[model samples]
Target: MIDVLIVDDDKLVRKGLMSAMPWDSFGMRVIGEAANGEKALEFLKENHVDLLMTDVAMPVMSGIELIRIVRKRYPDMAIAVLTLHQDFEYIQEALRLGAVDYIAKVQLEKERFEEVLGRIHGLILNQRRKPPNEPASVDQDVYPLDTAYAVLGLGDHPLVNGPRQHSQGWRVEADGHILLWTPDLREELWTEVNSDREWLPPLPDQALDADWRLVRLRHIAGLTQFDLLQMVRNYRQRDFFYDCNGYETNPIEKSVQELQADQPEPSEREIEAVKEILHAFRWVHDSQSFEELCSQLRKLRLPASKLMQLLYGFIVDWSRLFKALAKTGITLPDTFLCWSEVVAWMGGFREVAATLSGHLQLSREVTVSIMSAVKIAHDELEFPLFAVDVAKRVNLSRSYFNQCFKAIVGYSFNEYLRRVRIDKAREYLAQTAKPIVWIAEHTGYADEKYFSRIFREQTGLLPSEYRNRHRQR
Candidate 1:
């Protein structure tokens, strides 16, 4: 049976999960339970666990922290995050940290338990069967080509009946279009009709069903199956950006190498222009300035990849500048697949920028006071600090200060204090050979054991273990 450990801060949640799930029938057993990440780590240290089911938010150590530590310490163990709909950002982090799957808490009762268990079990088995040292192959059938072939798009043609099987050559379907890669052009697939371009053939509408029509049929040579799919995607993205009528008959004669070489880095002038736009946008909230910025971006002739890189840099800057002011739940996609996606993201960010600009315009004084309080908190981490004391230092009532603090910082004063203290403790443990007791005392914990408990709760590892782990790294 697969030995599982369930970790959650809620006693009721842990007990309910343990009792409600039919573990025996699924060939799994919940051999252990933990109140939080720290307790989970303690249980893991003493027992052999095959799978760990954990919640995202908890009292001391967060599910993200637990997943990070567990992934490193127990690379063989499978992890599945227990998440709510609101915990999307945390869930993303968990998945990036090697979580194989997620169980939605809200859907647990609504969905079939057997199906969930079966899916988890299948994923765990697949993960175990993978070799540790090599990257997982995207497709087992992917093989290097001795001679690259031309890839053609056959748009929803009934000539090809099934998926991944075509008599002409290797076939792959993407976005309702069938892509075929062959050594030579098959004339039988198309009918000669009126065409402005000599190389292009006009598709016969009578041959297709009423539901289907011929889209663009162009060919690019020197591509493998993987490269063919990628080229098709690039073509689609190009079509979207250019607003092309699918009838463009021009063949893509440029090789993949040529395409790669065409994507140049943003020049120094472009970089400086972006910086100027960002500065102006942040400090000056004129609608005309926003329009000008968008116009300038649209006028650029940079490839989608380079444009995305520039935009991603802008996103990073915005993230750093408005981190405290922005809601903690907001998440931006790390990569954009096409120009349309980038445009959509920019539109969303425009709304966010307007909201943040309003905050800056109306709450300049509050922002300054909160920032001062944060600076004081950072500077005075060694001593006992309380919200009431910080509020007094910042010249505000305790309750009012808390309201502004949470509004601007996305965390309560006490929670932020604990996080900073533990963060400092972590730095000391990792960078220095200092005694655990001294580190604890210096980080505002009077008792070493109590400090260790809190540290474990935040990090899922004791001070010594954390230090040792970092040292090994």
Candidate 2:
């Protein structure tokens, strides 16, 4: 059997890997577990292990250092990393250091255990059958093409005039933009070109003001002319998705299969929790609560698709609530490619939320009317309560009642009622193992499929999947 050693800082994670996985089924055995890279090295010195599955971040020696050492000491042993979505940079580094593959820590759910282990098993087997001197099946230096080149962009500045040639690279002007192709793959080369003030011409009385943009694929030796041009076009198209200051390392290039594989369906409960926190932020303006929201978001480790969905929901809801207060356009990109982009976008959103919250001014009468209407919707979930009926009950005209409800609740009366029923259905699904049809009927959804469709739209999960996720939690 293939012997495996698992290393992570968390005792719970180590224990989970040791006990929860069916190692024998994959023709592997968990021979040992370690809390950190240092401990892992110590264990390796005394034990025989064929596979090392390690986490990238730890207290003592990091996984990167451990991999570097282990690669030299035991070149034949297979290495894999346990990584979160945000650890892509570290993952790239590990892969470059000869890691065969990586397993997402979030994919350790019981249902996905076999699929993950099987993939790892296959990779290790492939490595064992390959000749040591042979290069990897696919060339890392050039990706999706044969030739290697690099793309560089220099902004309008006094130091750079039009397209200029360097000894290391060729430069040309395209569409009023400078495009440079270089075969140099060294980090220092890109760093100096992008940021080294010494490489730039000194101004007489001011600091250098220039924007240097570099685009390179990870593990690529260089980019081809076609690849460079394609990447440059992609960079321009996705300008809004990236931060303005930093050079783009990996452009937004992903296959549909890769995106679908990366996106994990978020539960209704998860979405609701975020909404609750955001709603609280809108009214109370509590810094602690907002910080907690950020903390929770980080902890969730949501993939870009799910994160974008959650943020889109928030923006749409907020836009409805603050329609009159909205002085500027609020929008979201079609998708986000990385966690850092999401964080940057969220920072801007925090400002928008604060600005809109400050502009909110609700009178006692409006507040009471809205609250009463909300209470009625909650109390009469099974009944078909129309907005007009609730409006009359709250002693307001239909139009006035709709305006107040949307302003206060961040959803239209119909939308709010639908959400209330779905939320009620979610409670039933989580708290008890009730039949889905029964739950649907009680939540005012006569058809189970209709209820599931609505639930999926709101939560990104089906009723059953949402229930299963809650149980796993």
Candidate 3:
């Protein structure tokens, strides 16, 4: 049975909630009750609970504060909020602090209450089975690759970008690229076809798929247990854990298998440094003062490359928090790809700081402005929708608008427009049997060749190849 705790300031309310539900039916039992966050903390110090359901308002400490404290202290524990109609704001804040669900205080009937309890129970069980840091393991005995050969050197691509149906095989990563094992004989066939690096897989109406830039290894015959282990080590440094795009249905199990001791824990001074940088980022959004923020960043006295890495790590940390807060998919721009290029393109750490601050302020008016602009641009993607056009609608200058948009949305106006169009093209390719020319035009491209070029640049696949691969999936 799952242990539970109830926290509310009102004594009668706490008692009523404790007795209101048949928690045992849902494999839960209220092990304790507290009248406020203070009492709850005291209880938690002496006891343990799988779940904590608390009221938003309380004396000594508010529920929001308690949730923050618990999130930092006991991250694995599930949390829920007790909220009245006017307390929804608190519930939102609670959820931002990692609350799993919220309960309407007035609707604590047995049926509704049991349903919510059951869900929390299931969530706890599911999370126990799959921690975020642990990779899913695969059985090599059942899926042997001894008779097959592998193709290596395919650069970063989506892990699940494979045919829907095929004989048993696995895609692995090595040397900062991907490898695929399958029954194969001709090593020269792929080399000759992709000699110019032009042809790709999943071509429209093609019965046979081509190897998409994956170089077949002639010397290495088949995959062994040692090969898989080495693949894990190769992937450990490829930032695969930070890249959120390739998690679903990924065959590579050890995507985040970094050596902990090698990755030295941030020293006490380093933690304080990051906190100072975060404070500066927060101050920028609050005061709209870029100079003061830059002054803070400059005070760190780190070189440009180290500064970029620090900023990148800061963004990664916040991205994780943003994902938790929004309970939605939030992928940062792959700007961490080349630090020198990103620093040069961003002009300095100041712009990078500003951009990250904007991303952190998702609930602010600045976010609303950018989102409105996105809606308008997406509505008129086929037309020549320019940044100036969006700025005009949002009542801001193009230059300032681009700055805020990049900060808040993590991409410039043109880059976002292209990405949105490409995303639409992906949808069309996957869902419809339209011709490549039709898809290109339908997604705002007048020339199919231009569209294909942009598509390859964005997705590493031609229109036909993407369509075929996604369609099969």
Candidate 4:
């Protein structure tokens, strides 16, 4: 039988999950539950959990960190994340760290949650592929969601965060389920039944976070396994790209349509600008902070062209990220898609900052710490948070965190952060299919011309051309 743990600070979430059903009948059993990630990690060291269902945001230790540690030690561990809609960034980070899926706690009731769990349990049970290189875990029960499910919420969650993990119903019958919905459910929870008027259990008095709930949505149907998986992937991608360096705030669907209204590029231009920008930015460039160049552009010395003439020497940043991912042969996904896709699949400014800070540096721990914070900031879409602040969140120190990060990631805090923002702009130009002006604002570069110049330098292709070239399938 599969060994699993249910983690959530809210007592109701925990209680509802616990009483949902006994896993032994479904080829699994509940091993334990923890209130927080720190506690969960401690439990993990002494015990083994084949699967994990956890909340993303929690005090002491966020679910993101817990997954990070778990993925490192147990890559095959099946993971599901739970968080509020506002916490998409956290979900994105967790996705990148390898949580297979997420659920909006307010959405589905315990019954639906258990159904999804059954499907996930099915996927885990069905998986037979083993990493060719790594030693196989003796636990045959450990399984990850299929890639399709990873991006979808488990499978067709109407919302980015919902109970979409399960495709069909559960196998065994419950003796009796006392359906409970959290009293404070602000809005109707995602695609599930809430009609059961069963009184729900309350959260533990010591629960963390504000506004806990026990909820069940009513009348959920027409959801199949395939449809659900697609939904999860779509949401996963959206969350990943939501705060990426190049995230356009709008979808390429617009640009795809606009391509009809606007004329194609002049024959002479030929997207050479894109080529030039990429060529220029092979190294030295980071975060669109070229002052002398910006000064001249501000003075009207250069033409206001769509070409990314400013971006230069940014390949180093890309190189760093590329190298890191190559270690796993996993390509990071693009940011700026709609919600519900693979978390790592999204990439952008926030991603660049985190990647450059940690990967550009030679140091491992400092890089890891910075990566942790950047990831948190990216998940939250808030940046420039203090080093100390990031350190504290990741349970590190100002000095040791700095040292460890520098030692592993290979860039000092400031220098690496600069690279992150700039590279994010470059990526935006190439990936998001957004306008140059908008890309500048999102990547922390207010000046469009300067942003363009930096783009040209780093990518050797002007913003538009680079985008065109990469945009072509």
Question: Over the stretch 1-473, how does candidate 3's per-residue lDDT look in tens digits?
Answer: 78999999888888887788778887788999998888898999998888999888788998888898888888889898887642333344676566766666754554456555654665466557766887632312222211223332222332333332234334333221333443232444445433433433222221123212222222222433334333333232222333222222222222112211122223558646655645333432344544444444444433333455666665665443232222333334443432234334334433443454455754345654665676565667777788898898877889988987776656788988898899888888888888989988878899999999999999999989998788677
| lDDT tens per residue, model 4, 278-324 | 33322113334223333322332111122113222233334454344
Candidates sorted on TM-score, descending: 2, 1, 4, 3
- What lDDT score belongs to each candidate, Candidate 1 first? 0.63, 0.64, 0.57, 0.48
Weakest lDDT window of 10 consecutive positions for candidate 4 = 170-179
Clash pairs detected, candidate 3: 202-465, 355-407
TM-score of each: 0.32, 0.40, 0.29, 0.31
lDDT of 1: 0.63
- Any idea what lDDT model 4 has? 0.48
lDDT of 2 by residue, 38-153 (tens): 99999999999999999998889999999999999998889988876523443667877888667778656775576567656766766676787888543244433222223333
**lDDT of residue 410 for candidate 4:** 56
Candidate 3 global TM-score: 0.29
Off by over 4 Å in 4: 86-90, 128-473
Measured with C-alpha atoms, the lDDT of residue 354 in candidate 1 is: 51
lDDT score for residue 132 of model 1? 81
RMSD values for the candidates in order, in angstroms, are 19.3, 15.1, 24.0, 25.9
Which of candidates 2 and 4 reaches a greater lDDT? Answer: 2
